[model samples]
Target: MSILKDKNILLGITAGIAAYKSAHVVRLFIKAGANVKVVMTPASKDFITPLTLSTLSKNPVYSSFTDEEDDNEVWNNHVDLGLWADVFVIAPATANTMAKMANGVCDNILLATYLSAKCPVYFAPAMDLDMYKHQSTKASFKKLTAYGNKLIPAGTGELASGLVGEGRMAEPEAIVKFIENDILVQLPLYGKRVLITAGPTYEALDPVRFIGNHSSGKMGFEIAKAASNLGAEVVLVTGPTHQKIENHLVAVKPVVSAEEMYKEVHKHFKSSHIAILSAAVADYRPKNVADQKIKKKDTTFTIELEKTKDILKSLGEIKTNQFLVGFALETNNELEHAKGKLKAKNLDLIVLNSLRDKGAGFGVSTNKVTFITANNTIIENELKSKANVAKDLMELILKQTHA
Candidate 1:
């Protein structure tokens, strides 16, 4: 049995000189037992054909997120594609593609998949040394890290431009091994690890419904995926959703309610080098949960509510030197509250989400966020896709790791 058994992996090909090597990367993903689907940027076709990738992946390739091809019974749905995968890997991600991935330019289907993906993604850079070493490219890399995406460092090799230093994509074997070593659940956590709690935790009132927010677990899963890509063993503790992490690169422990989330995260937080409490945890749960569906008594029924366990605070108490990151989604006074949580929870940094802004926050393909560190350093960003948002988060984590 393979570690990637029965998993959905989206292979995103960007415009790059080394697009040719991505074929080998696809081959490796397939050999590892993943059901590979390919998304190609328009420029990538200049280097490789859809037919070639289709033959390799055994699935029809999709080029645009919104393209409805002739005679196609089922229209291309980016949400369906996003929900379809266990992981999204962008091999030979060019400087242009990487920049777009960071900046939220949905020029193609590959970028849309990155924007909407609710799972782990691996962004592998492939470009000429000069272009790769440029400041813009450097910024793009930083942006990706800030979003909590794994960056597979490019290697040195002969370049398509006849000049090279360190811009080749890592070998297929090495990339595959990166997935195995970083993502797969290993006993390494028994010694050292990073724990992440993700998705949306519901506070139920009755059997049929509950008080919950739309987390979708997109960013949180991106963090786990990024950490796994970087060789840090990860544990993803997630809540209820249609999402499934089977056969993932890392150990995934699923739970539903706030109580279950507390139990699971508390059990493993101690061993983590870092813990990102990214789940949209319910702040108030029903004071009394009904075992059966509550019947409507009148036009309006009132119910008492209680505060949820302060997961971050509890973790902060016994957290020791381990790192902790928090997320704050606000309707108003976004920066103020996010900064407050950074200090109150003993977090190194806290991500800010403003529901007031368009194309950002909760149940959408795009996000506009601000990053606040414990030092009160504020970095403001514009509206971009979530995949790029993921990259930006990864950079912050890397900075923290280095610091």
Candidate 2:
């Protein structure tokens, strides 16, 4: 999935020959799952109709401060438009608009919104080569960038004047990619590799049956999504579950048995900066496996069992600099057990969940968890959605790691 997914994008259009390309820009943003709104300079309507942009964006296009509808003037709030955007992109920014922006000109609604915007602003310059190279235009570039507005350098191409050179606005795809990369590089977890395990690992007893818990893998999947959104490259080794996620940063590896999960986790752990093991792996598996399904012949039967590999403890023993995290589900002496696991497993942090707490653990959307640090710091959190819990856990990890 594109990093632009679910983002609110405010597209600003100006009166330039390149303004025609803004339509494709809006289409691409919408294709990438962004909610788009267009703000155009009044004169820009001569180049591209607001009706076309409004149709593509599914939102009303704003060109003037007031609109006449049924003889009633409805005011368009520029401040509200600016505040609603997560990102603002001004494509085909004419030299006129560029100078206005650099000089604090706010005659147009688009300019007014730009002046009021608090989010990052990106401008793609479009003009004739001569105008682009003019001293005044260069000054505008310098001033705008100095004010922290990102500049998408004009590409070399044929202009409306039939001259081939730089000053053509970047292609729609390239603009989208540039913005996505810009957003990613500024995230806290950028360039970090995270290894996470999720779901209940099944211990096979027969082809038709297995030993597993009620764990839905919801918590772990939530964590993976949260980590990916924060710009971490995540490896999610998950057991059988119905949970699904679509993120470019998260690579999902499906496993069934505890041994399979253990192997997958280890493969990625060595190269990971952080490893969060949240899978509910069975502690034991049948010592012997029946090749065929064993039919019930008697009222009672027994099968020998043996200990499965302890993936978390193994990682803790071999961990060098990785921030290791584990989960402890306990019904009694929760704090003591979680702290003990944190120290015993050499984990940097441990999350404790008590089954006794309602709306928490397995199959549910909510969770109540307590975080225990290696130094025995205890922080209890109220019941919250699993997604929120994952975010909180990540925040705690960031604080510890950055500290």
Candidate 3:
């Protein structure tokens, strides 16, 4: 998925020949799963109609401070519009608008909204080569950039005056890509790789039956999503579960047994900066497996079991410059056992979940956890949904790793 997914984009249009391209910009943003709202200078309507932009964006286009409906004037709040946006992009920003923006001009609703916006603002200049090269225009660029507004450099192309030079607004596709890259580079986890394990490992006894737990893989899946959103490339090794995810940054590896999960995790652990093992892997498996379903020929049945490889401990032993985390779900002596495991397994941190606490443990959407660091520091957290828990865990990891 595009990093722009679910972002609120406020598109500002101005009076310039390139204003016609703003329609395509809105379409591209919407296609990338962003919510778009258009704010246009009144004169820009001459190039592109508000009706067309409104139709594409599925939201009312704002051009003036007031709208006349049934002879009633409904005021459009510029401050509200500015506050609602996660990002603001002014495309085809005319020389007139650029000068005004640099000088604190707020005559138009678009300008007013820009002045009031607290989010990052990006402006794409559009003008003839001569006007773009003018000393005043150069000063505007310097002033706006010095004020922290990003500039999408104008492309070199044929201008409205039939002269070919660098004054044309960037193409819609280029504009969207530029913004996505800018947002990603600023994220804390950008360029990091995370390895995560999730779900219940199934140990099969026969073709018809196997052993597994009630783990829904909800918590681990949530962590994968959280990590991906923070700009990490994730390798999620998951066992049997109905949980699903749709992030481009996450690669899902399906495993059926504890053995399979162990191998998959190790494959990616060496290159990972962080590894979080949350899978409820079976401690034992049937020593001998039947080729086919075992019919109940007798009233009773017994099968010998053997210890499965401990994935977390193995990773901890070989870890080098990698932050390793583990999960401990205990019914008794929760803190003592969790702390023991944190040190015994060589984990940097361990998340402790007590079945004694209501709304916690397997098959539930909520979790109450206590974090135990390797240094014996303990931090308790309130009951929260799995998604929020995932976010909290990531925040803790960020602080510890200084990523």
Cα RMSDs, all models: 14.8, 1.3, 1.9
lDDT of each: 0.81, 0.94, 0.95
TM-score of each: 0.56, 0.97, 0.94
TM-score of 1: 0.56
User: How well does candidate 2 score on lDDT at residue 186?
Assistant: 92
Worst 10 residues of 1 by lDDT: 183-192
Comparing 2 with 3 on TM-score, the higher-scoring candidate is: 2
lDDT tens digits, residues 1-403, model 3?
6788899999999999898899999999999899999999999999999999999999999999999553678899999999999999999899999999999999999999999999999999999999999999999999999999999999999889999998999999999999998998899999999999999999999997998889999999999999988999999999999999987889999999999999999999999999999999999999998899998788889999999999999998999999999999999999989988998899999999998999999989999999988888899999999999999999999999999
Alpha-carbon shift of residue 243 in model 3 (angstroms):
1.9
Q: Output the worst ten-in-a-row residue range by lDDT, candidate 2.
A: 65-74
Off by over 4 Å in 1: 1-29, 32-192, 246-248
lDDT of 2 by residue, 1-403 (tens): 7788899999999999888999999999999899999999999999999999999999999999898453578899999999999999999899999999999988999999999999999999999999999999999999999999999989998989999998989998889999999999999999999999999988888899888899999999999988988899999999999999988899999999989998998899999999999999999999998899989999999989999999999999999999999999999999888888899889999999999999988899999999999888999999999999999999999999992
Better of 1 and 3 by TM-score: 3
C-alpha lDDT of residue 169 in model 2: 91
How many angstroms is residue 12 displaced in model 2 relative to the true structure, after the best TM-score fit?
0.4
- Output the lDDT of residue 57, model 2: 100
